[model samples]
Target: MTDIPPLPETLQFTADGLIPAIAQQFDTGEVLMMAWMNKNSLAETLATGRICYWSRSRRSLWRKGDTSGHIQKLIELRYDCDADSILVLVDQSGAACHEGTRSCFTRRLEIDGSISEAETAYPTKIDESARQ
Candidate 1:
Protein backbone atom coordinates (compact mmCIF):
# COMPACT_ATOMS: atom_id res chain seq x y z
CA MET A 1 0.00 0.00 0.00
CA THR A 2 1.19 3.49 -0.73
CA ASP A 3 1.71 5.78 2.21
CA ILE A 4 -0.92 8.45 2.53
CA PRO A 5 0.36 11.96 2.64
CA PRO A 6 -0.50 14.25 5.50
CA LEU A 7 -2.88 17.18 4.98
CA PRO A 8 -0.77 20.04 3.79
CA GLU A 9 -0.75 23.23 5.81
CA THR A 10 -0.91 25.18 2.59
CA LEU A 11 -4.57 24.39 2.02
CA GLN A 12 -6.56 27.55 1.41
CA PHE A 13 -9.76 27.66 3.33
CA THR A 14 -12.31 30.35 2.67
CA ALA A 15 -12.80 33.28 5.00
CA ASP A 16 -15.00 31.06 7.09
CA GLY A 17 -12.30 28.42 7.32
CA LEU A 18 -14.09 26.01 5.04
CA ILE A 19 -13.03 24.33 1.81
CA PRO A 20 -15.22 22.76 -0.83
CA ALA A 21 -14.97 18.96 -1.11
CA ILE A 22 -16.16 16.96 -4.07
CA ALA A 23 -16.95 13.29 -3.57
CA GLN A 24 -16.83 10.92 -6.52
CA GLN A 25 -17.29 7.20 -6.97
CA PHE A 26 -13.83 5.76 -7.22
CA ASP A 27 -14.52 3.08 -9.83
CA THR A 28 -17.29 4.58 -11.94
CA GLY A 29 -16.06 8.18 -11.81
CA GLU A 30 -19.54 9.40 -11.03
CA VAL A 31 -19.58 12.54 -8.99
CA LEU A 32 -21.62 11.85 -5.88
CA MET A 33 -21.86 15.18 -4.10
CA MET A 34 -20.14 18.38 -3.06
CA ALA A 35 -19.93 19.70 0.47
CA TRP A 36 -17.87 21.87 2.74
CA MET A 37 -15.16 20.74 5.08
CA ASN A 38 -13.26 22.53 7.76
CA LYS A 39 -9.91 21.40 9.03
CA ASN A 40 -11.37 19.31 11.81
CA SER A 41 -13.71 17.38 9.54
CA LEU A 42 -10.96 16.75 7.03
CA ALA A 43 -8.69 15.41 9.73
CA GLU A 44 -11.39 13.11 11.00
CA THR A 45 -12.03 11.75 7.53
CA LEU A 46 -8.35 11.06 6.98
CA ALA A 47 -7.99 9.40 10.35
CA THR A 48 -11.15 7.30 10.25
CA GLY A 49 -11.31 6.43 6.55
CA ARG A 50 -14.91 7.59 6.43
CA ILE A 51 -16.26 10.73 4.77
CA CYS A 52 -16.98 13.70 7.00
CA TYR A 53 -17.85 17.31 6.28
CA TRP A 54 -18.51 20.54 8.07
CA SER A 55 -22.18 21.25 8.19
CA ARG A 56 -22.77 24.97 7.85
CA SER A 57 -26.34 24.71 8.97
CA ARG A 58 -25.67 22.51 11.98
CA ARG A 59 -22.42 24.23 12.79
CA SER A 60 -20.70 20.92 13.48
CA LEU A 61 -19.00 17.98 11.87
CA TRP A 62 -21.32 15.90 9.73
CA ARG A 63 -20.34 12.30 9.24
CA LYS A 64 -21.75 11.10 5.94
CA GLY A 65 -24.35 8.33 6.36
CA ASP A 66 -24.38 8.58 10.10
CA THR A 67 -28.11 9.09 10.09
CA SER A 68 -29.00 7.97 6.59
CA GLY A 69 -26.93 4.76 6.26
CA HIS A 70 -25.59 6.13 2.99
CA ILE A 71 -22.01 6.13 4.10
CA GLN A 72 -19.07 7.01 1.88
CA LYS A 73 -15.94 5.03 2.56
CA LEU A 74 -12.80 6.83 1.61
CA ILE A 75 -10.76 5.29 -1.19
CA GLU A 76 -8.49 8.24 -1.76
CA LEU A 77 -8.22 11.94 -0.96
CA ARG A 78 -6.76 14.63 -3.17
CA TYR A 79 -6.31 18.38 -3.21
CA ASP A 80 -6.18 20.64 -6.19
CA CYS A 81 -2.94 22.33 -7.23
CA ASP A 82 -4.30 25.60 -5.93
CA ALA A 83 -4.97 23.86 -2.59
CA ASP A 84 -8.40 25.48 -2.38
CA SER A 85 -10.57 22.48 -3.17
CA ILE A 86 -10.63 18.77 -2.38
CA LEU A 87 -11.57 15.61 -4.26
CA VAL A 88 -12.52 12.48 -2.37
CA LEU A 89 -12.73 9.21 -4.22
CA VAL A 90 -15.04 6.90 -2.30
CA ASP A 91 -17.12 3.75 -2.18
CA GLN A 92 -20.60 5.13 -1.74
CA SER A 93 -23.49 3.24 -0.23
CA GLY A 94 -27.13 4.07 -0.87
CA ALA A 95 -27.89 7.70 -1.81
CA ALA A 96 -25.32 10.42 -1.63
CA CYS A 97 -27.71 13.35 -1.79
CA HIS A 98 -30.08 14.49 0.94
CA GLU A 99 -33.00 14.07 -1.47
CA GLY A 100 -32.14 10.32 -1.58
CA THR A 101 -30.69 10.63 -5.08
CA ARG A 102 -27.50 8.83 -6.07
CA SER A 103 -26.01 12.20 -6.84
CA CYS A 104 -26.90 15.85 -6.34
CA PHE A 105 -26.21 16.53 -10.00
CA THR A 106 -29.26 14.72 -11.31
CA ARG A 107 -30.31 17.63 -13.50
CA ARG A 108 -28.87 19.23 -16.58
CA LEU A 109 -29.22 22.60 -18.21
CA GLU A 110 -29.91 22.51 -21.93
CA ILE A 111 -28.32 24.80 -24.50
CA ASP A 112 -31.78 26.23 -25.11
CA GLY A 113 -32.10 27.29 -21.44
CA SER A 114 -34.29 24.50 -20.19
CA ILE A 115 -33.69 22.04 -17.35
CA SER A 116 -33.95 18.28 -17.66
CA GLU A 117 -33.47 15.28 -15.44
CA ALA A 118 -30.33 13.36 -16.22
CA GLU A 119 -30.32 9.57 -16.46
CA THR A 120 -28.82 7.76 -13.52
CA ALA A 121 -27.38 4.28 -13.66
CA TYR A 122 -28.98 3.33 -10.34
CA PRO A 123 -32.40 4.05 -8.92
CA THR A 124 -32.67 6.24 -5.87
CA LYS A 125 -32.86 4.48 -2.52
CA ILE A 126 -34.90 6.85 -0.40
CA ASP A 127 -34.28 6.71 3.31
CA GLU A 128 -36.93 8.54 5.35
CA SER A 129 -34.77 8.57 8.42
CA ALA A 130 -32.20 10.67 6.61
CA ARG A 131 -34.53 13.61 6.69
CA GLN A 132 -34.33 13.79 10.43
Candidate 2:
Protein backbone atom coordinates (compact mmCIF):
# COMPACT_ATOMS: atom_id res chain seq x y z
CA MET A 1 0.00 0.00 0.00
CA THR A 2 1.18 3.51 -0.71
CA ASP A 3 2.06 5.57 2.31
CA ILE A 4 -0.23 8.48 2.96
CA PRO A 5 1.61 11.63 3.89
CA PRO A 6 0.58 14.07 6.56
CA LEU A 7 -0.62 17.57 5.76
CA PRO A 8 2.40 19.82 5.50
CA GLU A 9 2.82 22.30 8.30
CA THR A 10 4.42 24.74 5.86
CA LEU A 11 1.30 24.95 3.73
CA GLN A 12 -0.23 28.37 3.51
CA PHE A 13 -3.86 29.32 3.97
CA THR A 14 -5.94 32.40 3.66
CA ALA A 15 -6.69 34.62 6.64
CA ASP A 16 -9.78 32.50 7.15
CA GLY A 17 -7.65 29.34 7.09
CA LEU A 18 -8.69 28.16 3.65
CA ILE A 19 -6.59 27.19 0.64
CA PRO A 20 -7.67 26.90 -2.98
CA ALA A 21 -7.64 23.38 -4.39
CA ILE A 22 -7.99 22.59 -8.07
CA ALA A 23 -9.24 19.19 -9.09
CA GLN A 24 -8.13 17.79 -12.44
CA GLN A 25 -8.42 14.54 -14.35
CA PHE A 26 -5.28 12.54 -13.74
CA ASP A 27 -4.73 11.21 -17.26
CA THR A 28 -6.53 13.78 -19.39
CA GLY A 29 -5.48 16.88 -17.49
CA GLU A 30 -8.98 18.24 -17.67
CA VAL A 31 -9.71 20.60 -14.86
CA LEU A 32 -12.90 19.54 -13.14
CA MET A 33 -13.45 22.25 -10.57
CA MET A 34 -11.92 24.48 -7.94
CA ALA A 35 -12.81 24.45 -4.28
CA TRP A 36 -11.56 25.59 -0.92
CA MET A 37 -9.89 23.37 1.64
CA ASN A 38 -9.34 23.88 5.29
CA LYS A 39 -6.76 21.96 7.27
CA ASN A 40 -9.30 19.44 8.54
CA SER A 41 -10.75 18.79 5.12
CA LEU A 42 -7.29 18.42 3.61
CA ALA A 43 -6.29 15.96 6.28
CA GLU A 44 -9.42 13.94 5.76
CA THR A 45 -8.83 13.79 2.02
CA LEU A 46 -5.24 12.65 2.51
CA ALA A 47 -6.36 9.95 4.87
CA THR A 48 -9.26 8.66 2.82
CA GLY A 49 -7.89 9.06 -0.73
CA ARG A 50 -11.14 10.77 -1.61
CA ILE A 51 -11.46 14.41 -2.45
CA CYS A 52 -12.81 16.68 0.25
CA TYR A 53 -13.22 20.41 0.41
CA TRP A 54 -14.31 23.04 2.85
CA SER A 55 -17.78 24.34 2.13
CA ARG A 56 -17.51 27.96 3.05
CA SER A 57 -21.23 28.52 2.77
CA ARG A 58 -22.15 25.37 4.66
CA ARG A 59 -19.39 25.74 7.23
CA SER A 60 -18.54 22.06 6.93
CA LEU A 61 -16.41 19.55 5.10
CA TRP A 62 -17.76 18.63 1.67
CA ARG A 63 -16.96 15.20 0.41
CA LYS A 64 -17.01 15.33 -3.39
CA GLY A 65 -19.37 12.44 -4.07
CA ASP A 66 -21.26 12.19 -0.80
CA THR A 67 -24.23 14.03 -2.25
CA SER A 68 -23.63 14.19 -5.99
CA GLY A 69 -22.29 10.67 -6.43
CA HIS A 70 -19.75 11.95 -8.94
CA ILE A 71 -16.86 10.89 -6.80
CA GLN A 72 -13.29 12.07 -7.32
CA LYS A 73 -10.89 9.27 -6.56
CA LEU A 74 -7.48 10.63 -5.79
CA ILE A 75 -4.73 9.52 -8.13
CA GLU A 76 -2.15 12.04 -7.00
CA LEU A 77 -1.96 15.19 -4.94
CA ARG A 78 0.40 18.10 -5.57
CA TYR A 79 1.10 21.53 -4.21
CA ASP A 80 2.45 24.56 -5.95
CA CYS A 81 5.96 25.78 -5.21
CA ASP A 82 4.45 28.53 -3.12
CA ALA A 83 2.63 25.95 -1.04
CA ASP A 84 -0.48 28.11 -1.09
CA SER A 85 -2.52 26.16 -3.64
CA ILE A 86 -3.25 22.49 -4.32
CA LEU A 87 -3.79 20.40 -7.40
CA VAL A 88 -5.63 17.13 -6.92
CA LEU A 89 -5.24 14.66 -9.74
CA VAL A 90 -8.17 12.29 -9.69
CA ASP A 91 -10.02 9.61 -11.56
CA GLN A 92 -13.40 11.24 -11.68
CA SER A 93 -16.49 9.09 -11.89
CA GLY A 94 -19.53 10.53 -13.65
CA ALA A 95 -20.21 14.24 -13.88
CA ALA A 96 -18.00 16.35 -11.69
CA CYS A 97 -20.19 19.40 -11.60
CA HIS A 98 -23.27 19.57 -9.42
CA GLU A 99 -25.11 20.76 -12.54
CA GLY A 100 -24.34 17.36 -14.10
CA THR A 101 -21.62 18.64 -16.41
CA ARG A 102 -18.39 16.75 -16.96
CA SER A 103 -16.49 19.80 -15.84
CA CYS A 104 -17.31 23.11 -14.22
CA PHE A 105 -15.26 24.84 -16.93
CA THR A 106 -17.45 23.76 -19.82
CA ARG A 107 -18.12 27.36 -20.80
CA ARG A 108 -15.49 29.28 -22.67
CA LEU A 109 -15.04 32.99 -22.94
CA GLU A 110 -14.18 34.00 -26.47
CA ILE A 111 -11.67 36.66 -27.42
CA ASP A 112 -14.54 38.86 -28.56
CA GLY A 113 -15.97 38.64 -25.04
CA SER A 114 -18.88 36.39 -25.92
CA ILE A 115 -19.32 33.23 -23.92
CA SER A 116 -19.45 29.93 -25.80
CA GLU A 117 -19.80 26.33 -24.95
CA ALA A 118 -16.72 24.12 -25.18
CA GLU A 119 -16.46 21.89 -28.26
CA THR A 120 -17.36 18.68 -26.46
CA ALA A 121 -19.41 20.21 -23.71
CA TYR A 122 -22.50 18.28 -22.73
CA PRO A 123 -23.93 17.57 -19.37
CA THR A 124 -24.38 13.95 -18.44
CA LYS A 125 -27.65 13.05 -16.76
CA ILE A 126 -27.17 12.80 -13.06
CA ASP A 127 -29.06 10.23 -11.05
CA GLU A 128 -32.18 11.64 -9.39
CA SER A 129 -30.91 10.51 -6.05
CA ALA A 130 -27.83 12.62 -6.54
CA ARG A 131 -29.77 15.83 -6.71
CA GLN A 132 -30.09 17.90 -3.58
Candidate 3:
Protein backbone atom coordinates (compact mmCIF):
# COMPACT_ATOMS: atom_id res chain seq x y z
CA MET A 1 0.00 0.00 0.00
CA THR A 2 1.08 3.60 -0.58
CA ASP A 3 0.96 6.45 1.88
CA ILE A 4 -1.04 9.57 1.21
CA PRO A 5 0.91 12.46 2.63
CA PRO A 6 -0.70 14.94 4.94
CA LEU A 7 -1.31 18.60 4.07
CA PRO A 8 1.75 20.68 4.75
CA GLU A 9 1.84 23.37 7.43
CA THR A 10 3.44 26.15 5.38
CA LEU A 11 0.69 26.57 2.79
CA GLN A 12 -0.11 30.26 2.62
CA PHE A 13 -3.80 30.80 2.28
CA THR A 14 -4.83 34.26 1.13
CA ALA A 15 -6.39 37.01 3.22
CA ASP A 16 -9.77 35.58 2.34
CA GLY A 17 -8.56 32.29 3.80
CA LEU A 18 -8.23 30.76 0.39
CA ILE A 19 -5.44 28.96 -1.45
CA PRO A 20 -5.02 28.14 -5.12
CA ALA A 21 -5.34 24.44 -5.76
CA ILE A 22 -4.54 22.69 -9.02
CA ALA A 23 -5.91 19.27 -9.75
CA GLN A 24 -3.97 16.91 -12.01
CA GLN A 25 -4.82 13.51 -13.33
CA PHE A 26 -2.65 10.92 -11.61
CA ASP A 27 -2.49 8.53 -14.54
CA THR A 28 -2.05 11.03 -17.35
CA GLY A 29 -0.51 13.89 -15.38
CA GLU A 30 -2.87 16.19 -17.22
CA VAL A 31 -3.93 19.35 -15.50
CA LEU A 32 -7.60 19.09 -14.66
CA MET A 33 -8.56 22.44 -13.21
CA MET A 34 -7.54 25.28 -10.97
CA ALA A 35 -9.71 26.26 -8.06
CA TRP A 36 -9.57 27.94 -4.71
CA MET A 37 -9.93 26.34 -1.29
CA ASN A 38 -10.39 27.51 2.22
CA LYS A 39 -9.18 25.54 5.21
CA ASN A 40 -12.51 23.93 5.83
CA SER A 41 -12.89 22.73 2.28
CA LEU A 42 -9.36 21.43 2.23
CA ALA A 43 -9.81 19.54 5.46
CA GLU A 44 -13.12 18.11 4.40
CA THR A 45 -11.70 16.97 1.08
CA LEU A 46 -8.86 15.27 2.85
CA ALA A 47 -11.20 13.61 5.25
CA THR A 48 -13.59 12.45 2.58
CA GLY A 49 -11.05 11.63 -0.14
CA ARG A 50 -13.18 13.65 -2.53
CA ILE A 51 -11.88 16.83 -4.07
CA CYS A 52 -13.54 19.99 -2.81
CA TYR A 53 -12.95 23.58 -3.82
CA TRP A 54 -14.04 27.05 -2.82
CA SER A 55 -15.85 28.66 -5.69
CA ARG A 56 -15.03 32.33 -5.67
CA SER A 57 -17.91 33.26 -7.91
CA ARG A 58 -20.42 31.05 -6.13
CA ARG A 59 -18.88 31.93 -2.78
CA SER A 60 -19.30 28.39 -1.54
CA LEU A 61 -17.55 25.10 -1.15
CA TRP A 62 -17.60 23.06 -4.38
CA ARG A 63 -17.29 19.34 -4.27
CA LYS A 64 -15.79 18.19 -7.60
CA GLY A 65 -18.21 16.31 -9.80
CA ASP A 66 -21.11 16.79 -7.41
CA THR A 67 -23.52 17.84 -10.14
CA SER A 68 -21.99 16.34 -13.26
CA GLY A 69 -20.67 13.14 -11.70
CA HIS A 70 -17.18 13.95 -12.93
CA ILE A 71 -15.64 13.63 -9.49
CA GLN A 72 -11.99 13.83 -8.62
CA LYS A 73 -10.80 11.28 -6.12
CA LEU A 74 -7.72 12.27 -4.16
CA ILE A 75 -4.55 10.27 -4.54
CA GLU A 76 -2.11 12.77 -3.09
CA LEU A 77 -1.74 16.44 -2.28
CA ARG A 78 1.44 18.47 -2.51
CA TYR A 79 2.58 22.03 -2.08
CA ASP A 80 4.77 24.13 -4.31
CA CYS A 81 8.07 25.72 -3.30
CA ASP A 82 6.44 29.06 -2.43
CA ALA A 83 3.90 27.30 -0.21
CA ASP A 84 1.23 29.60 -1.62
CA SER A 85 -0.35 26.94 -3.81
CA ILE A 86 -1.42 23.30 -3.80
CA LEU A 87 -1.19 20.41 -6.25
CA VAL A 88 -3.71 17.66 -5.93
CA LEU A 89 -3.11 14.35 -7.70
CA VAL A 90 -6.42 12.75 -8.37
CA ASP A 91 -8.24 9.96 -10.14
CA GLN A 92 -10.54 11.91 -12.40
CA SER A 93 -13.74 10.56 -13.89
CA GLY A 94 -15.47 12.03 -16.96
CA ALA A 95 -14.55 15.71 -17.43
CA ALA A 96 -12.94 18.33 -15.23
CA CYS A 97 -13.99 21.63 -16.71
CA HIS A 98 -17.52 22.85 -16.02
CA GLU A 99 -18.12 22.79 -19.77
CA GLY A 100 -17.24 19.08 -19.57
CA THR A 101 -13.69 18.88 -20.90
CA ARG A 102 -11.30 16.20 -19.76
CA SER A 103 -8.65 18.76 -18.92
CA CYS A 104 -8.31 22.51 -18.54
CA PHE A 105 -5.19 22.60 -20.72
CA THR A 106 -6.58 21.67 -24.09
CA ARG A 107 -5.17 24.82 -25.66
CA ARG A 108 -1.98 24.99 -27.63
CA LEU A 109 0.68 27.66 -27.50
CA GLU A 110 1.78 29.54 -30.57
CA ILE A 111 5.29 29.31 -31.98
CA ASP A 112 5.94 32.79 -30.64
CA GLY A 113 4.94 31.41 -27.22
CA SER A 114 1.63 33.16 -26.95
CA ILE A 115 -0.71 31.38 -24.61
CA SER A 116 -4.24 30.33 -25.50
CA GLU A 117 -7.12 29.08 -23.37
CA ALA A 118 -9.43 26.22 -24.31
CA GLU A 119 -12.04 24.09 -22.55
CA THR A 120 -14.54 21.37 -23.36
CA ALA A 121 -18.18 21.90 -24.20
CA TYR A 122 -20.35 18.87 -23.59
CA PRO A 123 -23.79 17.73 -24.70
CA THR A 124 -22.93 17.60 -28.38
CA LYS A 125 -20.14 16.96 -30.86
CA ILE A 126 -18.13 19.96 -29.71
CA ASP A 127 -15.09 19.42 -27.51
CA GLU A 128 -13.67 22.89 -27.00
CA SER A 129 -14.61 26.51 -27.34
CA ALA A 130 -11.73 28.94 -27.29
CA ARG A 131 -11.26 31.10 -24.23
CA GLN A 132 -9.23 33.70 -26.11
Clash-forming residue pairs, model 3: none
Q: What is candidate 1's TM-score against the reference?
A: 0.85
Model 1 C-alpha lDDT per residue in residues 1-102, reported as the tens digit of each score:
123337799999999999999999999989889999998889889888999899999999999999999999999999999999999999999999998889
Alpha-carbon RMSD to native, per candidate: 9.6, 9.8, 7.8
Candidate 2 structure lDDT: 0.86
Output the worst ten-in-a-row residue range by lDDT, candidate 2.
118-127
TM-score of 3: 0.77
Sorting all predicted structures by TM-score, with the top scorer first, yields: 1, 2, 3
Regions more than 4 Å wrong, model 1: 1-6, 121-132
In angstroms, what RMSD does candidate 1 have relative to the true structure?
9.6
Give TM per candidate: 0.85, 0.84, 0.77
How high is the lDDT of residue 11 in model 2? 94
Q: Is candidate 1 or candidate 2 better by TM-score?
A: 1
Residue 98, candidate 3: Cα error in Å is: 1.0
Q: Write the per-residue lDDT of candidate 3 for residues 62-113, one digit (tens) a residue.
A: 9988899999999998889999999999999998887667877677665479
